[model samples]
Target: MRNLIFLFFIVLAISVTSCRKDFSTIPSFGQLEFSRDTVYLDTVFTNIGSATYNLKVYNRSNKDITIPTIGLERGNSSNYRLNVDGIPGKTFDNIDILARDSIFIFVETTVDVTSVPDPLYTDRILFDNGTNQQDVDLVTLVQDATFIFPGRDPISMEIDQLTLDGEPTAIQGRFLEDSELIFTNARPYVVYGYAAVPANKTLVIDAGARIHFHDNSGLIIDRDASLKVNGTLNEKVVFEGDRLEHVFSNVPGQWGTIWMREGSKENEIHHAEIKNAIIGVLVDATTSSTPTLTLKNTQVYNHSNFGILGRGTSILGENVVVGSAGEASFAGTVGGSYDFTHSTFANYWNNGIRALPAVLVNNFFTFTNDQGQEVIEPRDLTQANFINCIIDGNNNVEFIPDRVDGATFNFNVSNSMIKFNDINGSFTGVAELDFTDTNLYQNITLNGFADFRNTSANDFIIGQASDAIGLGDPTAAAQVPMDILGVIRTLNPDLGAYQHISF
Candidate 1:
């Protein structure tokens, strides 16, 4: 009787184990819920990979269900790809989800225009099989682009790099060829690395040309080289990052700057929009008496650093607007000659705490020497003038004049609106900060009302009630007769870049 009882207990344990293994999942019956009915992957340059997006597959029913087949409508040849259960493929089978739970389906795409056969690349992610099938639509816009990248060595796998000061550097770049001097508007140019202009050569960008740069990519004009951007009022040139997604449109520091390096001469940019860069335009130090950079009717916004940073260079600007920078909107450091008329330098930086002013003018800089000693270099600021310009921001001080006393710092800000509250008395006893001086600062409306239409949206048009509507100097307005947007400025023009307009 004891042996029989032990055998019965063993059989009971086996039966319980078999019953657990017999549990089953129900087949999906067109009841799967999805996060969205369609996924718009956004526009992208051809042959460029898009940002990854996810779709949540929820099983709201009480029973655990198994999707028999999850496949793309185009089968294995589709441009779209899927990742399920740590495996990547175009088709998956037996995808199971628990009751009242959800599983994510990640999607990505890299398509070529030539192979897509159509401008709109469409695909569908089909779940299950036969009558119980459910699908999510996938759509993307593919754009053809003229790709520019540095050449690589086949054997060593080494990419061409820029050499600085007779030493090899990690900056991946190559000088542009002779045939690539002119950039037209036929197709957008997508640059993967720094495209350097050869010495003594000139690169011309025609109107309506769009230049998109990847991370760290920029345009560098070498010694004696020049760059001319001829954009019209209606068809303006655009320089921005390669990301065409909506969320990345206004994000700053996506790429580098359009650097007119040291010794580069006669750089001119007109009617261009430069955004989402470390620096919109960088005019390095030059000994030439003429203007290093001529910027006219240009708008530079959403820059991580200065919109236009001039270092010991001469800049002549008219009808220019720079808005919202992490640092200054326009920073003339190390003693540069700047002459701006009918321009606006506004900084309503909302990203984080910004201690610097919107417009910064400093004549001195410090650096460490070879012998470990810190040395101070003060250059003469021959001219730092802003006529009929508005330099304002959310900070108490939007304009700072930093002089080291060892150099000649001369700035005449006449007929302009400025924001200098001096909340902490930091500029107390500073000769340059004295706003009462007629020679340095004249006819300035300090902290007066300059009602911008919408600073958050970057629309800097002044309204009728704004104090700057008729505060401009007539002589200065004549230099920049039209506003940045091609509107004719009145005889008594506004102080900022734009004339008074109805909101």
Candidate 2:
């Protein structure tokens, strides 16, 4: 009985010690360490939530410390929200930190455009009381956008989807109405899903219009519909993902392509920039008999796939610049007709191993037949001409001219800088890419440097030291009198989309 009572007393003592509270804490003396002195919330649209960011708070002292108050400087009026440890609130009281321990503080924001007094909304996370206070700065840029999203069904609650063949598709999108057919520079347009142009309708974008797409969102032109971008030299139309943050500025594949279906005729884009997409421009089934699209003084950059994909389509390009694609910068596949004058097609992608060349023109496509056997289908390549252009990349062979037996393949490259190194004898038996054939290749500078001005900065301007200076065909220069930057090309013109800069 005595031993049992002793064991019971010992167990009771252990339980009491464990249940005892340790409320003793020294006030924080402004010695709190932070993971970052300034937390940038990136950029967010008006009334849209920002990506969640985190910051760590450390207590270096050996003794436990109590923060008198942890809150935003603006208190309840601030647009920011803080989650201290696990609890979320605008302000917290008596937050304690164990000895030499740290806690994570998550930050998020959603601000209204009208509520923000300036472009940048700022606040501070304050710690402790008057004399023993420490603070971490917070900053975020807020932009106003005209948002367009699909509506949900009233009864079925099904999200709106793109229509194809009289049935809804998995693509979350809706067709544009008559009133929304025109876009202006009044505000930046933010598209949530695919904004499809209805059949036989035209979508017009005015100069200086900025169109931003969300993830997997893009613009699509339906059959018999057209797209017209009326941009000018001073005011260019911009198409990109809606991240708006500095980190995502040059990132690729944030959105989908600008796809133009067959029968979408008379499409034009001039002095515009299209970037950060899976494919900058995708032309499907637009045959080479007539001009499918006209691209002039435009820039396409940082695409995950081809910069300009032409599937049996015809395109007339002048002073067009394409840059940095995972696949070919410009791909004219399935036997398309392409004419590019005073243009630049360069791929300096450092992302991964690229199997495709910078520029490719093929006269055939392959598919599996009913017997599950691969079959080649040939299409006639009417014309693929590159005059006074620059087709160069990091690869040894930057241009590929593919030809199949059933189709007629015609191509000409005159007074251009190209990169074609067949050191491995890859084309020993292929007659399609014969460099000695003067009829197909004329005045070509084989494996020569164009000497671009800082390709890493996406600056394709030709430097004075470049050998391509004064190497352009005079007739082609006369056709495209002005360069992409509105500089008049002299009779002794330079190759590529941009003219030679003295610097």
Candidate 3:
């Protein structure tokens, strides 16, 4: 009885193991995958016009699969035929199977929709391999017709003729409440030409906003209204042309000007990039007592005339760059109280900074003029103070003094560097000044003219040598603690932009 019971238990265990082996030996196939399951047509089309679309078919399986034919079907009905060769209604004959390969197919077809009817249509591409078939759907929607013109159009023709009073008139542009104005490229509009401040309105621009001008479009701020444009460092505002190719050319009077009209007050422009304009910023005598044009960390480049042409009443300019200009980068005519500091004026066709009377310049960098002989032409400048600055002039050119009649020009320089030419004969006009220790050169040139007065005062301290070391007011030697290049000023101040540091 014990033997029979053991034999029955052993046979039951063997039968269970045989069933597990049979289940494990069952065959399973991998999944079929595709790169894309849907296609989208972004444009809305009308009439019998045709559009071409590119489709990429990827083989994702490990084994190679053959695609014999692919055709488009609409609503379970073949509306149009797919072309494999040159003709329609043919199977793709030159098809091949490849493992992990992608093939691009171009499908060009005409729409059967008539007239200007807007509708959403669903179409699909069906691929057939004898009995096996797969379908990929495509969705497309048609929209209103858009006309593309060749070049920029006139500003007046582009915008709707709506006046400020909500009346029907041929007003060229519209102004939003958020101080934003959009100008289309239909017609060119001359701002500040017909009306200043957009017909009795204050112009305020948002930070990081862009004011695009069509070809030959400009704005002027009349004496009545004020212009306030303040931008942050990251999102600085821009005044640019609509088309990238159509920049403001170097032609005088080509575009309009910003005339701070008489009686206009409290105008502030900061952190802005004004590029490729005819004349960048023009400040005239019409400004009021409280009218202040404060330009800070702003860049003005590629202009026809001066970068900032100012006259009269307290303009504060700091950290500004005027580069690649046609004429003078800064042409300050007549009389204006200017407090300009920590600025760079470079690569101008004419003078870098042309100063008249009543200008106080401090802590600035002026590069050599590539076109003219002079860099900073101070014409009768009254009390021009240059502290901690760098002046570079190429071609052995001198800092020209403007020949203005009856103007007293006083230049006070401390801690600055001026180089005339590079070693390779490139014009890098940075002048060397050393004020810490007394060392004499064979010949010393002071302010473009040879000056042997106190030749011992030009020596720089060892290890504290710079281009702008001891060029400060010699009489006020005790007052200037350090040079412009951040070196400690000794008994005598350095002559150049940098002070010599021991170590």
Candidate 4:
């Protein structure tokens, strides 16, 4: 037994010695290859952490190599953090790699505005030491802007409360000040929480203004408040997520919606682009006789839920485009007055299976009341008119009218291209259910092939061979003389928002 133990100890010692020989001690100069010389980390707002970016350090030589040190040039005081071979640290020592093998160097940053000299923060990743030292540039464009987040009490950090749907909810938000009412294009605005426009106030976004919201953050227009976006053709206002990386450009559900709450009025959005949100614009309650919202030459795309959700509200949209939503691209819910002219509502959502249609009109909603009983609310759909529009999607049926009896459901879809087939008998287009009558749905083509410029990439521009071309009412063209692109429309204009521009 003693002899066997001695032999086992000797074998273990030899194994440990052999394992140590895997790395080479030979010093190398200018032989290390990298996947990228300059790693561009994602752009981040002030004091916000960025996503981790990786760099591959390859050992191309035949022999194994040992990197004595791997660190940031800023040393311990650096804002950037590095991770080498799964070990998180600001600096790593004695990192070894086999021949033709590679190791990953992950880097992340969370910089404060006071730490950097300028908004463009730059650093270097130093590898090795002495005469053979090498480095790779690390650049991050840090943006400094006005951050509107939920303000809390300094002592207890207690958030404010807002009444939502008759329920008092704790929210991280505050009403806008007079100074903050006008958002400019000087710097990007980053919102951490809901930014509310109080009653009797108007928040105006200037041309070329870019507003980025963090997850679940959005703009809220309160009762009697207004939100007017003054964007132009050349410089459109952009509302999207805070992530500035290319990978996150079309990602859905990155943020919340521009919520126009009950009694909110006179909201106008023109030449604006809103994307990657759960719900693009949610307009609730039409308290006044005037239209609650007016959308012109605007795009609300890449939403997880409805692009435009109007709950008993009045909306007038022209030359608008709503694209790629998991639910209906435009949902006139619980009855509303909706008018869309020369607009395109297309949902080619390929990310997941979509069960709903692109355009949904409903006159009622069923919900449970506080008494624990199911309650149904009947809302009168005053009007839902679509003129010279394209309501199409990848699905066979892209339009659905969910109307309950007893409620007034009045709608007209004239000279439009719609995708609706009643093969399943779900919507038979009988009486008040759908707009199938010739008088109500006049000159409309049902399930016509759109032949769009590119459906996959969310381009709804119609081709020359499309059935929508030259189908617009000549009288309608005279009403709205220009298209979304500011192009003059002919007297007998093409259908949809773009007027069939040449590809």
Candidate 5:
């Protein structure tokens, strides 16, 4: 009797183990739930891979279910790639999930224009088989670009280089043809090398046109050439690096600059967003009586160096916001003519050791002569006028006026909020920051808290308690009828690029 009882116990244990091994293979019908029914991957350039997105496949039932098949409806011909539950393939079979558990389906795409029918690429991720099949739609807008790169001399395989800043650097570049000079929104332009606009030519970028550049590539306006970026409030022209990956989104120095060479004439940038560059707009030697670059309702930010570096150039900027640069946000160096109204120059650069201020006005620069001796050359700053503007930065003093007595340092700041604190007389010796002198500065609030809506995120919009509200010169505000966003400014408007907008 004892032996029979022991054998019965052993058999019961074995039966329980066998029952545990028997997992329910019956596929759960209509039991699968997804985080989203559709996934939109947004816009990506042709022949480039898009950022990976994920779809959560949930088993909401009480019993474990095995999806017999999970595959793209388009099969192997589809441009979209998928990875199901850690397995990468176009088709997956028997993907298992525990009760109340979920699995992730990763989706990515690198599509060629020729392989896709329409710019709006669409595909579906189908789950299960036959009647109980459920699917999630995958859609992405693919854009075909007119790629501009230097052509090699078929015999020599040599490309042209650019003589930038008196240094000849080997760069893959070519002059733009007449047909390519007029950029439109019909198709984006992805430039791999520098696109030089020849002398006497003009490159007009229409509103909503997207211009993407590769690393170290930029647009060069030769002598007598021009660049007119006609952007609007709703649709602004975008100039950025071609690295569409999320990692490069806010990075600085991704590309070169919109270099308006010494004699480039009548270059105008309006309602444009120029970002992620070494120098946003490098205006060189514009000595015209009229403004060389008329920047209106434009934003040039996230530059590694100066946002708008005017080396003896003339600029008349209105409703401009320049933010976050390794050096100064707006540098009028070696003297230049600059008149900024309703503009904001805020530098909250925590990237590195930023020694310069937000706005730098200097009248001279030191350079080595042929004999290797340091020679200071005078470049008279005819005018560095800031009216109804907000110039603030993380530093105690955001405005720097480095003047050489021999050269002229003509600057006027009226009805503006500046961050200048010289309690220690660090900058008080300079006449520009001497609050006692009304000729150089007037009605300027020193070290006034801008009360920015969000400084950490580079949002310069002011709040109710901010000192910038109603601090603008009504006369200057009348000139810039509208703010950067096209909002009609009141007679007594707030400072900065944007008008005082309440939430």
Candidate 6:
């Protein structure tokens, strides 16, 4: 009887283990997926302004998912509304999605903004699909609704009660006893004509400050004075025009300019966005050598002439994007030197960058137009070293060296990528020591004199197992210390900005 009881217990244990294994093979309900990671707003608006965006819903499980309703709500407020057609924050219902299928839900909202009171603000929109919800934030700011009158010094305007739709708004301004001025507002304002910075005085601008310009209006810093514009990433300080639309309108010389006059030093500008101007940042000849002009994470876009014109010396940090409308993007004339790293030069009608014979440019990416047959012409560039840079252009657009009447231009490029659709007519003037990797598709058509003694076509490194692989000058600067990307510097660096170590 005891043996029979023990055998019965062993069979029961085995049965229990078998049942647990069968239940583990079963699948769960479903998973949710979204369309985008983040949304960005390019301009600021007020009062019944609306923008539309779409959210894609994906069903990842085998079972069907039912979206009963879709709506939006403010994260801070209990007020929730359905996102529907024609109405802001209107919701749609009865949307059935099959397994491995997706659908798009549109979201639109009208925000009430006022210019007489505070100018800039931000808010978040919470998107809920019955069971799950996601949040997206939006930013808005008031714009200057007025134009400037040209030909005026110290342009002045009266501060009466500025109202927004008959509402008492917050308007603040203060003039110090020593002729120093301070202006603060929640709404947008404009500056007309040429505004001059007084001598021996400092101008301090807070973050999220938006200053607009009337036609031909800009700021000029005279000798013995300084301007400090300190802004944050989220709350960046912008200097632009007073236009309703933020599109490029070819408004040449219509915005303000910042001129650092002679004898002026120690001017610092950080985290600023300067746009829609004629000349963005002008460092005059009188700028003292001790006070280096520093620009960090700054963007100068949609300008007419040079983006950042420096007649003196300057130091630009990483991640600088400069774009032009129809002319040269950057021109450094008169004894200018630039130490730029991880910067971009894009979208210009004329030359992308032109450094006078006295200037030096290092570690930059330059993009020129293919339609325009114009080449970047600098005068007397002494030592222009391109390290891990990218020069992109079309076949028609050629790379023309600076025209030195008597002196020679010394251009040394290492671990770089210079691409042109038409290599036949690309690059003019003879180079002293041209270390080019022959990975260019039209390398046979390239026209120029190069020091081929220390270079080899086998040294040109290609992206992959292409014919131009292993062709470049082994003695290039990028090969010595390696580049920002970790690839062993070879005797021949790759043809473009990036070097491929392994497949």
Number of the predicted model whose TM-score against the real structure is largest: 1
TM-score, one value per model: 0.92, 0.89, 0.43, 0.90, 0.80, 0.46
Model 6 worst lDDT window (10 residues)? 450-459
Ranking by TM-score: 1, 4, 2, 5, 6, 3
C-alpha lDDT (0 to 100) for residue 83 of candidate 3: 46
Lowest lDDT 10-mer window, candidate 3? 21-30
Single out the weakest 10-residue window by summed lDDT for candidate 1: 150-159
The C-alpha lDDT values of all candidates are 0.89, 0.90, 0.46, 0.87, 0.87, 0.47
Checking candidate 2 for backbone clashes, the offending pairs are none
Candidate 5 per-residue lDDT over residues 1-503, each given as its tens digit: 99999999999999999657456655858669999999988678888788889999999888888899999999999999999988899999888888889999999998887777798999999998778999999998888887887653323324666565457878667788898889998878887678899889999999999999878889999888999999999989999988776667889998999998898999999899999999999998875798888999998888998888988889999999999899999999989899999999999988898989999989998899999999998879999999989999888878888888788889998888888875677764566668658898888887787887876667888877788888877777888888998878867688888876665
Q: Model 3 over residues 122-146: C-alpha lDDT tens digits? A: 6677676444667767755543221
Candidate ranking (lDDT, best to worst): 2, 1, 4, 5, 6, 3
Q: What's the CA RMSD of model 5 in angstroms? A: 8.2
lDDT score, candidate 1, position 61: 96
Off by over 4 Å in 2: 1-25, 33-38, 54-64, 85-88, 94-104, 114-119, 152-158, 287-289
For model 2, the run of ten residues with the poorest summed lDDT:
150-159
RMSD of each: 5.7, 4.9, 21.8, 4.1, 8.2, 20.1
Worst 10-residue lDDT window for candidate 5 reads 150-159
Candidate 4 per-residue lDDT, tens place, 25-106, comes to 5555558999999999878877888888999999899877788889999999988999998899998888888878999999
Provide the global lDDT of candidate 6 against the true structure.
0.47
Question: Per-residue lDDT for 187 in model 5?
Answer: 77
